[model samples]
Target: MFTRILTSALFAGAAAGLIAALLQLVFVQPVLLHAELYEGGELVHFGGDSTVPAEQDLGGLSPVRDGLSIVFTMMIYSGYALILVPLMALAQERGARIGARTGLIWGLCGFIVVHFAPGFTLAPEVPGVAAADVGLRQVWWFATVLAAAVALWLVAFGRGWAAWGPAVVLLAAPHLVGAPEPEVFTGPVPTEIGALFAARAFGVGMAAWVMLGGFAGHFWARETAGRDAAAQPA
Candidate 1:
């Protein structure tokens, strides 16, 4: 079972990560490069003195950087898979169906727990955004993700008000306490560019997660069946 879980997660995570890398390169990278121009004072917004050149191209792709990005994304997604597959097993043990179609829903839930929950209070930031202390933000982000995950599980699988009641509180607790914030919000990145970056980031994330869930489910089913077959009489 342990071997099955590890192998399935690695294979699924690698496939999904590749897809995610392509999507980020195409959709998210250009917006990031554009925002960096503002951060570096090359492009000024709101009528500031600027050193802007006409027909500027936001092309900063490099082989080394992109290669590293691909590798990093794969590792990150694989880590995410390690968390996700065990939960799928638990859900199966509790009599929940697991398959490609259902995995899409699982993937969406994983996205909500890991990404959307934290992002609700702390939206994705550009290079030059004003923000809270890094340590505080990291603490809050992890707490929110943990709270959201437990809350979601209770809502999905828990029985009666005993479970439902705590689930609601868990979901609300993080938001009620609130995320740390800057005293005054200010940044060189324009609102339009920032908004676009956030949107694209969410889009790419959803696409990757959906693929991860499907692949993970498929591999899990395959491995389990293989094991069962091996144990059966000839």
Candidate 2:
């Protein structure tokens, strides 16, 4: 059973990751490239009380960088898939349906837990932007993710208001607790550019997660069907 699940996760995750990489190349990479210009001093938001021609930082989109980016995306998304598939298994045991359809919803829910929920306080950042300390941000992020995950599980699988009430509280906990804040909003990047970058990043993530969930669910169902047929008396 574990082997089946792992195999399904690998194949599905690789496919989804590749799809996500392509998406990031098209939609997300340009924003990152733009931000890096400011970070690297190639572009100055206000230079010498007037405008000046910024140096090209096109190297951000180079073939080497793109290649490494794809590799990293694949690794990260594969990890996500591994975590997601097991949750689907748990859902299955709880008498809930688990399939490509459910997977899409689950994927979106996962997005809410990991990205959307934490984003309220964190927002996406560019290289030159101010931020809270890395260690503190990470601690807060993990706590938020965990609270949201538990809340979602309760909403999905928990029995009654007794369960539901706690779930709501858990869902609200992170927002109430709040994320660490940056002391100053100092940065060379424009607010519009930063906002756009964050939106595109989330869009790319949603696409990849949808693909991962759909593929994992579809493949796992097929694997289960194959096993059942083999066991049935001929």
Candidate 3:
């Protein structure tokens, strides 16, 4: 059981993470680097002297930095898969079908739970964006993620209003309490760039999560089947 979970999670997570890292580099990094320029006073929003570079340095193509990024991304997705595969197994035990298609739905739910849910309150930030106290925000973020995770699980597996009623409350409770806010909204990054970064980040997250779920489902099913077959008369 341990081996199955580890292998499935690692394979699925690594594959998904690799792709996600590439996508983030292509679609998200430029916006981030641009935002940093503003944050660092290298670029001014309205100053006549400031001109957008034809191409941003993008960290000078540092292999070490980029390589570490890929590895870190893989680790993160692998961690997510570690959580997801066990859940998949549990779901299967409860008669839930596991497959690539189903996994896509699961992936979407995961995205909603982890990214969209917290983001709905906090939104993604760039380098210069003014925000709440870090410790306070971290507390709120963790609570929100936990609440969202429970709500989703209950909604998925629990039966009738008994399960759903609480799910709704759990889902709404955090938002009602609200996330910590800055004393005042302030930041060096352009609103447009921040907005674009948030949008692209969410988009890339959705894609990565869907792929992760599909790969996880595929591998989990295959591993389980193989184990079962090995146990059968032979």
Candidate 4:
């Protein structure tokens, strides 16, 4: 049973991760490159003498980087699938529906857990943006993800308000506590560019997460169906 689930997770995760990497290159990397211009003093904010070097212009789109992106994405999404698929099975056992629809819902829940929940405080960082220490941000981010995931699970699977009320609190706790802030809000990137980066980053993440859930659900359903068939009387 675990083997089947693991196999489904690996397949679905790889597919979703590959798709995500492609989407990130298309949607997110350009902005990231642009932000680098400001960070590296190659392009000034607002208005200035800007002649972006050819090297800087195309630096963000690298074949090697893209390869790494795909590899990292695959590993990350596969890890997520490994965790999610089992929870999905448990949810099904507990009478929740388990299919694409539920999977999509779960995916959205995942986004809320990792992205939106943390985003409320941290937001996405652009290359030129200056903010909080990396270590502090990571600590907060991990805590937020944990809190949000548990909160979502409780609300989704818990029996009643007794469970749900606390879920809401958990969801709010991290935000209420707030994310780590930099000593000063300073960056070379424009407010508009930074804002756009954050929005696009979230958009890309949402897309990837949705795809992850959809694929995982599809594969999981198929594998479980096969198992059920094998167990049935001939």
TM-score of each: 0.93, 0.92, 0.93, 0.92
Residue-level error in angstroms, candidate 4, position 224: 1.0
lDDT of candidate 2 over 37-111, digit per residue (tens)? 788776777635637443344554688889998998888888888898888887887777888898888888888
Alpha-carbon RMSD of each model: 2.1, 2.3, 2.2, 2.7
Each candidate structure's count of clashing pairs: 0, 0, 0, 0
TM-score of 2: 0.92
lDDT string, candidate 4, 1-234, tens digits: 889889989987898889888888898888888888788886775535534442444454588878898899889989999988998998878877777777888888888888899998899999867788899999999999999999999987888999999999999998898888888866987676788889998998899899889888888888878878999999
Q: Decide which is better by lDDT, 3 or 4.
A: 3
**Model 3: worst 10 consecutive residues (lDDT sum):** 46-55
| Best by the lDDT measure | 3
> Which candidate would rank higher by TM-score, 1 or 4?
1
Q: Model 4's lDDT to the true fold?
A: 0.85
TM-score of 1: 0.93
User: Which is superior by lDDT, 2 or 4?
Assistant: 4
List the lowest-lDDT window of 10 residues for candidate 2.
Answer: 52-61
Candidate 3 lDDT over residue span 66-154, tens digit each: 78989999999999999999999999999999988899989999898888999998998878999989999999988998899999999
Off by more than 4 A, model 3: 46-60
Off by over 4 Å in 2: 47-60
For model 4, where is the 10-residue window of minimal lDDT? 47-56
